[model samples]
Target chain A: MNAKEIIARRVARELKNGDVVNLGIGLPTLIPNFLPSGITIIVQSENGFLGLGPLCDEPNPSLVNAGGEPCGIVAGAAFFDSAMSFALIRGGHVDVSVLGALQVDSLGNLANWMVPGKRVPGMGGAMDLTTGARHVIIAMEHCTKDGSAKILTNCTLPLTCSGKVQTIVTEMALFRINNGLVLEELCPGVSIADVRNCTEADFTVSPNCIATPGELI
Target chain B: MNKCMSLHEVKAVFRDGMTIMCGGFLGVGSPEGLVRELMSNGAKNLTLISNDSAFPDSGIGQLIANKRVTRLIASHIGTNPETGRQMIAKELEVILVPQGTLAERIRCGGAGLGGVLTETGVGTLVEEGKIKLTANSIKYLVELPLRADIALIKAKRADRAGNLVYEKAGRNFNPLMALAADLVIVEVDELVDCGEIDPETVITPGVVIDKIVVSGGY
Candidate 1:
C-alpha cells in the first residue's frame, strides 16, 4: 500500500461500530474504504447531511459535500439545513472527525486552515470538527514533500485549534495526545528512529506502546 | 398571499449594494437562475453570505467573476480561486467564518436572537476580535447574528403558499437563509398547490417567505 493508504488504513482502527464519522477532504477521505468488515459507521458531510457514501459515478450538481465535491449517500441517510447539520457536530454528537493537517505540535495544536502570505482558503468546518467532535484524529503525511517534519515542537503557522487534537496518524507511526504526543504504534517495518528522524515534535516512546496495524481491531 | 412572481419581478427586488444570503454549499443548493438574474440586473457591490463562493464558473462565482460582489461572508472559498485572488488583491472583503458558526449566526438572526456562543475557533484566529465569555469553566466565542437584505434560496418543491421542500444535500443553508433575510425569495424547481406538499416535510413555512420564482434555465 502507498503511504496515504497506510495512514488511512491505520486510522480506521480509531473508529468503532456505530460511529458518526466526518472525514476531511484529502488523506482522511481514504479511511472509510479501509474499515474492518461488518463495522458500520455513518459518515457525515459537513454541507448538510449524514450517511455520506462514496463519490458518485454520476453526481448531482446540487448534492455535493462540504468540499464542493460530488458524493453519494446510504439508504438510511438524513438531510437537514446547515444550522441543524452543524448543531449535530457542535453539540458533540459526532463520534469522530478524521482530518488532514498541515502541522501538529507536541501540545496537539493544529495548524491546517491557511498559510500566511499565501492566498487564504477559508476555514470551512475544520475548526468546528477539531473543537466539537468527541475525538479528533489528524491523518496526514509524516513529512512535507521535501521531507521536513510536520510534527513540530510548536506550529509556526496560524492554528486552527489549540490543544484539541487527540490522535495523530502518519505513515510511520500513530501518536496519542495525552498531555503530550505519546508514540504508541508503529507501522510494519517502521522503527522508532524513523519517526524521530522525521518528527520535530518532542514525543516520548510509550513503554508498552509499540504495536503494528490490525492490533487496534 | 400571492407570493409567486416572475423572474423579472424578482430582479426588481434587488438593488445595487444589497446584502444577499444565498443558500448553497459550493454552488449546490444555490439559486443559480436567481444569481444569474442578479448578474444581469447589474447589482454591484453586493454582499454575499453563503457556505462558499463556489467554483469560478458557477453560482455566485459568476457574480464574483463579474465583480458584482464586494464583500463575501462565508465558511469556505477555496473551491473558487477567483475569490482568493480578489481577497488577496483587496478587491473583496472576505470574512471567513467556521461553517457551523456561520450557520448558527444566521439562525440566530432569523430567530431574533442576540448572538451565538460557540466553542469553535475559540483559540484560533477567529477569536482575535470577538468577545470571549466563560460559563461554568467553558470558554466560547460570541458570534453576532448575520442577516441579509434579501435571501435567494433554491428549493426542490414549493407550494403556492411558499412552503418549501429541499432536495437531499441541496438544502444546506437555504432554510436558514430564508429565516434570516429581510425578503425571502425562493426559486423552486417544482411549484405545487398549497396542499400538495405534506406539512411535515415543509422545511420552511410560507409565513416567512416574501417572493417565489420559478426555477429558471441557466
Candidate 2:
C-alpha cells in the first residue's frame, strides 16, 4: 500500500461499529474507503449530511460534502440545516472526528488551517469538530515535503485546536497522547530508530509498542 | 396572505448596499432566480452572508465575480479564486467566521439572543478580538448574533401561504436564514395551494416569509 493508504487504513481501525464519525477534508476523507465491511458507522459532513456514503463517480453538483467534494448518500441519511448540523456536533452527539494536520505538538495541539503569510483558504469547521467531538484522531504524513518533522515539540504554524488531539496515526508510527507523547505502535517496515530520526517531538516508547498487525498494513 | 409573486415584482426590494443573507452550500439550496434577477438589476456595494462564496460562475460567487459585492461575511472563500484576488487587492472586505459559530450567530439573531458562549477558539487566531468569559472554570468566547436586511432562499415546495419544504441537503441554511432576516424571499420549484402540504413536513412557516417566486417546476 502507499503511505497515505497505510495511514488511512490505520486510522480506520480506530473507529467502532455504530460510531457517528465526522471525517475532515484530506487524509481523513480516505478512511471511509478503507473501513472493513460489516462495520457500519454513520459518517457526517458539516455541510449538513449525517449519513455519508462513498464518493460519487457520477457527478451530482447538488450532493457534496463539507469539502465540496461530490459524494453519495447512505440509505437512511438525514438532511439538516447548518444550525442543526452544528448542533449535532457542538451538542456532543458525534462520536469521533478524524482530521488531517499540518503539525501536532507534544501537548496534542493541531495546526491545519493556515500557514501564516500565505493566503490559505479560511477555516471551515475544523475548530468546532476538534473541540466538540467526544474523540479526535489525527491522520497525516510524518514529515513536510522538505523532510521537516510535523510531530513537533511545539507547533509553529497557527493552531486549529488547543491540545484536543487524542490519537495520531502517521505513515511511520502511531502515537497516543497521555501525560505526554507515547509511542504505541510502529508501521511494519519502520523501526524505533527510524521514528527517532524523523520525529522531532520527544516520546516514551510503550512496552507494548510493536509492529502494526499484518491485515492492517 | 397571497405571497406568490413574479421575479420582476421582487426586484424592487433590492437596493445598493443592502445586507443580504442567502441560503446554500455552494449552489445546492440557493435562490438562483432571485440571484439572477439581482445580478441583472445591477445592485452594487452589497454585503453577502452565507456558508461559502461558491465557485466563480455559481451561486453568490457570480456577484463577487461581477464586482457587485463590496463585503462578504462567510466561513470560507477558497472555492472562488476571484474572492481571494479581490481580498488581497483590497477591493472587497471579507470576515471569516468558524462555520458552527457562524450558524449559531445567525440562529441567535433569529432567536433574539445577544450572543453565545463557547470554547471553540480558545487559543487560536479566532480568539483575537473577542470577549473571553469563564464559567465553571472553563473559558469561552462570546460570539455576537448576526442579522440581515433580507434573506434569499430556495425550497423544494411552497404553498400560497408560503409554508416551505426542502429537498435533501439543499436545506442547509434556508430555515435558519428565514428566521434571521427582516424580509425573507423564497424561490421554489413547486407551488401549491394552502393545506396541500402536510403540517409535519413544513420547514419554514408562512408567517416569516415576505415574498415567494415560482421557478421552473421540479
Candidate 3:
C-alpha cells in the first residue's frame, strides 16, 4: 500500500468508540477517512471545536482547523473560545493524539517543532498535546532525504515534548517504546536486520517485542 | 439636548453564557463595549475562555466579581485577582491550557481542521493520559477546536460591506474568531461606506459578520 493509505489504515484500526482525537499535519491528518464509520470518533482541533469529522465542502462559518483553513461541518460539533478547546485537553477529555515528528529518541523524546539554525516559527501546540493525550503516537518517515535516521539515539533538536512517546510508525517499521527500546513490529518488506541497520537507537528484540506486521496479530 | 452618535460609537455585544475570545497579548484590545454589556446583562454560568482573565473589575474580571462566570478556560489567570479568588473558592472550573496551544486551537476551530496534534502538553499535567497511537512514537494531546455560539469582536473600523480593520493589540484574537462562530457580532469604533475601507487594512470581511454593533459614543 502507498504510504498515505498505510498510515491511514493503521491509524483507523487503533481508534475506539468515543475517542476524541487530534490529527496533526501531514500523514497523520488522513486517518479520519480510514476510521471505522460506525464508531464515530469526535475530532477536536485545538483551535476550538468538537465533533470534527472529515473536511466537507460546505461554507459553514463555524467549521475551522488549526491553520485557519476553512472546512466542512460534521454532526454534533460544538463551538467555544480557543481557551475552552485547550481546557478539554488539559482537563483530560481527549482520548488520543496523533502528531508528526522530526525525530524520536531511544527514550521517546520528540523533536517536532524547531531545529538549530533553522529560523522556525514559534512552537504551536505540540508541547501540550504530547503531555495531554492519553496515548501519544508519532508518524513520520524512517529517514531523512539525506538518509539520516529519524529514530535517533537521542534527539539533537529542540524538544517539543519529553519521553512521552508511546509508539512510533515509520515507513520501515512499527516500534513500541517500552522500558527502553523494543522493536515491536516491522513492515512486510523489511527484515529485523533491515530495521537494525536503519535505526540509530539501541534495540532489545525480546521475543515479545519483535514481530513483522501480521505476526503481532 | 439631542446628541448625535459620536465618531467612536463603540458597541459591545454580550449575552448570557456566551463564549468570548478577546484579542491582545494581555487585554490590550479587549472590546470595552462588550465588556460593559456583559456586566450590565448580569449573565450567569458564563464559561469564559481567553488569554488572561482581565484585571480587577476590568475586562472580564468585572464579570468574575459579579459571580457571572461558573467556569474559565484560559492560558493564565494570574492577571486577574478576582479570577484567582473565584478559583481558590472553587467557584470556577479553571482549566488552564498552555499559551501557544490555546492560540492554535482557536486557529484550528477557525480553520476547520479535524483536530490539530501538537506535542505541547505531552508528558506534563497539561494532558497526561489522553492520547492514542497513530504511529509508534509520536504522541499528541487532543486539542478540541473551539467556536463560540456568539462572538463579540473588537475592530477599529468597518466599511458598509462589514470588512473590519482592527487597531494594534485589537488584532489579537478577533480576526480568527471572525469566522469561527455562528454569530459574529463586530463592535467597531468607526463605520464607513462600503469600499471606503482600505482593502489591505480590512482584516475581517463583512461576509462573516452577522451584525455590526456600534462602539462607544463620541
Candidate 4:
C-alpha cells in the first residue's frame, strides 16, 4: 500500500464521529484526508484557530493567528486568542491528538520537543495537549538516521508528554501501550521474529493480537 | 559604544533576497537595525520566515509596509494585515506549517536533524495533496527543516566581545534562531564593555555571532 494511504487508513480506523482532533504536522496532517467521509473532526490549533482547513488563497491578515505560519484556512474555523486556544486543550475539549515524537519509551514517554545536550528553545503546546487530550497517538518513524530505534527502553531526552501515548504506528508494525510496554499486532505476513529483529526494544506479541486491520478495530 | 554602526552598514552584509529567519514572536526583541536595513535597501523577492508577522508600523509589519518581502513561511501571519492582503491577491506566497512543527523545523534545521514526521494534519485539508512518508511501522507527515542564509536577532544587551541576553518576550524565538542560522546578525539595545555581562546570563555566544550592530536608545 502507498505510505500515505496505509497511515491514513490505519489511523482512520481509530476515529469515531464528533472526535475533536489535533494534528501536529507532517504525517499527522495527512490524517484528515483518510478520515471516513461522514465524520466531521473539529480541528484546534494552539495559535487560536479551530476547524482549520488547508492552505488557500486569501489575503485577509486578520485571518492569521499567532502561529505566524501561512495555511489554507478551512471554512468556519472559529478564531480566538492563545488563552482561549489553550483552554480547549487544558480543559480537555480535545478528544485526540496525533503528535510526532523524536523518541518514545516503553512507558509511553515522548521526547518530541528537544534532543539532549542542545539548548532547547521551548515547548510550545505539546505539554498542554499531552495532558489534556483523551487519547494521544504518536506518529513517527521507527528509527533515527543513525539507526537508533526511537522506540526505546527509556527516553534519554526531555519529555513533551509523559506516559500518555495510547498507540504508536510505524510502517512496519502497530503497537499499543499495554502494561508499560508496547504490545504488537502482527500484519498479514509479519511474524514475532520479524518485529523483534526490526525493533530495538523487547516486546511481546499480544496473544489476542489480530492479523488483519479490521479484526481489532 | 564603539560597537555601534549605521543601519546601512548592518544591512550591507545581510542583503536583500536572502532567506532570513527572524526572532520575535510578535514585535518582541526583534533586531531593529537589521529590519530597518532590509526595509531601506528596498530588496525584493525576499522569502522572510519568522514565528509571526510583526504588527503594522512595527516589527516585521514595517517590512510589509515597505513591501519588501515576496514569500513567507511561517506558523502565524495574524499580526500583520498588509502581508495578508498580499497573500490573498497572490502577490506573495505563504507556506503555512503547524506552530510547534514550525519551531521544530527551525530547531531541526539548526540541529542537523532530517525532516520531522508527525500526525497533526492527518485526514484534513492540511494533508491535501502532500507527500506522506512512512518509516518502520509508523507513518509521519514529513516536514522539512528551514535554515536561513542569514538570521537577524534581537537581544537586550551585549558585552564588548558580544554575549547576548534577552528581555521578557524578546527572549522568545530569537535565541533559538541564532543557533540555527549560518550567519547570525545580532541587534542589541545596549552594548556594554567586554566582561561587563555575567557569563551565566549570556544566551548566545560571540563565536556564533558574525556581526553585532548596536541600536539607538529606545
Candidate 5:
C-alpha cells in the first residue's frame, strides 16, 4: 500500500462501530473505504448530512460533502441545513473527527487551515470539528515534500485548534497524545531509527510499541 | 394572506447597496431563480452573507461573477476563483468567518441575542479585533449577531401560507436566513394550499416569509 492508504488503514482501526464520525477533507476521507465490514458508523458531513456514504458511481450535483465533492448517502441518511449540522458538531454529538493536518505539535496543536503569506481559502468547519468532536485524530504524512518533519515541537502555521488532538496516524508511525506525544506503533518496514530521523518533536516510545499489522501494510 | 409574488416584483425590492443573506452550501439550497433575476436586474455593490461563495457557474457565484457583490461575509471562498481574484485586485471586501461561528451569529440574529461566546478563535487571527470575555476561568471570543436587509432562500415545498419544507442538504442556511433577514423571499419547487403541508413538517413558517416564488418546472 502507498503512504496515504497506509495512514488511512491505520486510522480506520481506531473507528468504533456505531460512532457518529466526521471525516475532514482529504486523507481522512479515505478511511471509510478501509473500515471493516459489518461495522456501521454514521458519517456526518458538516455541509449537512448524516450517514454519508462513499463517492457515488453516478455523481449528483446537489449531493456533496463539505469539500464540495460528490458522495453517496446510506440507507438511514438524513439531511439538514448548515445551522443544525454545525449544532450537531458544536453540541458535542459527534464522536470522532479524523482530519488531515499540515502540522501537528507535541502539544497536539493543529495547523491545517492556512499558511501565512499564502492565499487563504478560509477555514470551513475545521475549527469547529476539531473543537467539538469528542475525539480528534490527526491523519497526515510524516514529512513535507522537502523531507522536513511535519510533527514539530511547536506549529509555525496558523492553528486550526490548540492542543485538542487525541491521536495521530501517519505513514511512518502512530502516536497518542497524553501529557506529551507517545509513540504507540510504527508502520511495517519502518524502523525506530527511521522514525527518529523523520520526527522533529521528541516522543517517548511506548514499551509495547509494535509494527503495523502485515495486512494493513 | 397570500405571500406569493412574481419574480419581477421580488426583483424590484433589491437595491444596489442592500445586504442580502443567501442560504446554501455551494449552491445546493440557494435560491437560484431569484439569484438569476437579481443578476439580470443589474443590482450592484451588494453585500452578501453566505456559507460559501460557491463555484463560478453556481449559486452566489453568479453574483460574484456579475460583480454585483462588493462585500462578502462567508466561511470559505476557495471554490470560487472569481472571489479570490476580486479580493486580490481589491475589487471586493471579504470577511471570512469560521463556519460554526457564522451559523451561530445568524442564529443569534434570529433569536434576538447580543452575541455568542466561543473558544474557537482565541489565539488566532480570527480574534484580532473581537472582544474577549472570561467566565468560569475560560476565555471566549464574542461573535456578534449578523442580520441582513433581505434574505433569499430555496425550499423543496411550500404552502400558500408560505410554510416551507426543504429538500435534503439543500436546507443548509435557508431556515436560518429566513429568520435573520428583514424580508424573506423563498423559491420553491412545489406550492400547495395552507393545509396541504403538515405543521410539524414545516421548517420555516409563513409568518416569517415575506414572499414566495414558485420555480415552475424545476
Candidate 6:
C-alpha cells in the first residue's frame, strides 16, 4: 500500500461502530475509504452538517465541505446554520476528530495552522475539535521530504491546541500518545530502529507491539 | 410594512467605516448583490465579519480588493492571498477567531448576552487580552459579543415578511448573521407572500429583518 493509504487504514482502525467523526482535509479525508468492515461512523463537516457523503466526480457548489470542496450527503442527514453546527462541536457531541498536523510533539502539542514567515491557513475549527472531541488523533506523514522528523520533542510552528493529541498515525508506525509518544505498532517491513531513525521525539516500544500484516484485515 | 428595496436604496444607508457582518462560508451564501452595492457605493474603512475571506475574484474578496475594508474578523483567510497581502502590508487588520467562538460571539450579540465562555482558545494566542475565568476549577476564554451596524444575508427563499429558508450547506453563517446586526438586509432568491413559507421551516423569522432585496443577478 502507499504511504497515505497505510496511514489512512491504520487511522481507520482507530474508529469503531457508531462513531461521529470529523476528518480534517487531506490525509484524514482518505479515512472513510479504508474503514475496517462492519464499522460505521457518521461524518461531521464543520461548515454545517453531519452524515457527510463521499467526494463526488460531479460536485455541487451549495454542498461543499469546510475545505470548500464539493461533496455528497447521505441519508438521514441534516443541515444547519453555523452557530448550531459549532454548538454541537463545542458541546462535545463529536466522538472522534482526526486532524492532520505539521508537527506533533511528545507533549501532544499540535502545530499545523501556521509557519511564521509563510502563508498561514487560519484555524477554521481545529481548536474546538482538538479541545472538545472525545478522542483526538493526529494523522500525518512520519517526516518531511528532507528526512527531518515531524514528530518532535516540541513543535516549532504555531500550535492549534496544547497537549490535546492522543494518538499519532503515520506510515512507519502507530503511536499512542499516553505519557509520551508510545510506539504501539510498526508497519509491515518496518522495524523499531527504522521508526527510531525517523522519529525525533524519544519513545518507548509497547510490550505487545505488533507489525501491520501485509494484507489489511 | 413593505420591506423590499432596490440596490440604490440599500446603498444610500451604507456609510464609511460601518461594521458589516456578511453571511457566507467561502462565498457560497454571500449576498453578492448587496456586496456589489456596497462596492459600488465605495464605502471605506469598513469592518467586515464573516466566516472567510473568499477568493480574490469573488464574494468578500472583491470588497478587500477594492480597498474598502479596514478590519476583518473571520475564521479563515487562507483561500484569499490578497487578504494576507493586505494584512502583511499593514493595510488591513485581520483578527482571526475560531469558527465556533466566532459564531457564539455573534450569537451572543444577537441573543443579548454579554459574552461566551469556551475552552476553544484557552491555551493559545487567542486567549491573549481576553478574560480567562474558571468555574468548577476549569478555565475558559471569555469571548465578548460581536455586533455589527448591518448584516448582509443571502437566503434561498423568503416570505415578503422576510421569513427565510436556506438551501443545503448554503445556510451556514446566514441565519446567525441575520440576528446579530442593527440592520439586517437580505438578498433573497425568491420572495413570496407572507403566508407562502411555512412557519415551521422558517429558519430566520422576519421580525429581525430590516430590508429585503431579491437578487437581480443571482
- In model 5, residue pairs whose N, Cα or C atoms come closer than 3 Å (at least 3 residues apart or on different chains), thus clashing, are A81-B172, A82-B172
Report the lDDT tens digits of candidate 2 across residue range B1-218.
67888998888889999999999987888898999888898889999999889899988999999999999998888889899889888899988888999999999999899999988988999999999999999999999999999999999899988999998778888898998999899999899988999989898888888889998522
**CA RMSD of each candidate after superposition:** 1.7, 1.8, 14.3, 15.9, 1.9, 1.5
Highest DockQ: give the candidate number: 1
lDDT of 5 by residue, A77-150 (tens): 98877778888997899999999888999998999877654566778898888878999999999999899999
Give the lowest summed-lDDT range of ten residues in model 3 chain B: B1-10
Off by over 4 Å in 5: A55-60, B216-218
lDDT of 6 by residue, A114-183 (tens): 7665676789889988989989999999998888999999998888899989999899898988889899
Q: A1-217, model 1: which lDDT tens digit per residue?
A: 7999888888887789999999998888888898989888999888888998886578887677666678888889999888888889989999999888889998989998898658578789999888889999999999999998999989998999999889999888999999888999888788898889999988999997876745542
Candidate 2: where is the Cα deviation over 4 Å? A55-61, B216-218
lDDT of 1 at B210: 89
In terms of lDDT, model 5 sits at 0.88
Consecutive 10-residue window with the lowest summed lDDT within model 4 chain A? A114-123
| CAPRI class assigned to model 6 | high
TM-score values for chain B across all models: 0.97, 0.97, 0.86, 0.87, 0.97, 0.98
Tell how far residue B112 is off in model 1, in angstroms. Answer: 0.6
Model 2 has an lDDT value of 0.89
Ranking by DockQ, best first? 1, 6, 2, 5, 3, 4
User: For every candidate, how close is chain A to the native chain A in TM-score?
Assistant: 0.95, 0.96, 0.90, 0.86, 0.96, 0.96
lDDT string for model 3 (B1-218, tens) is 12123323322335567676655334555677767766776667777766667676677777777888888777656556677666767777777666657676777787887666766665545565555444457666677787777666777787766788865324556777777777666777787877788787566767887767567643
Which residues of candidate 4, in runs, are more than 4 Å off?
A: A1-217, B1-5, B128-131, B134-138
Candidate 1, residues B1-218, lDDT tens digits: the string is 78888887767878988899998887788888898889888989899898889889998898988899999999888888989898888999999999999999999999999998889998788999999999889998999999999999999999998999999888988998889988999998999888998899889999989888898631
Candidate 3 error regions (>4 Å): A209-217, B1-218
Positional deviation of residue B85's Cα in model 4 after best superposition, in angstroms: 1.6
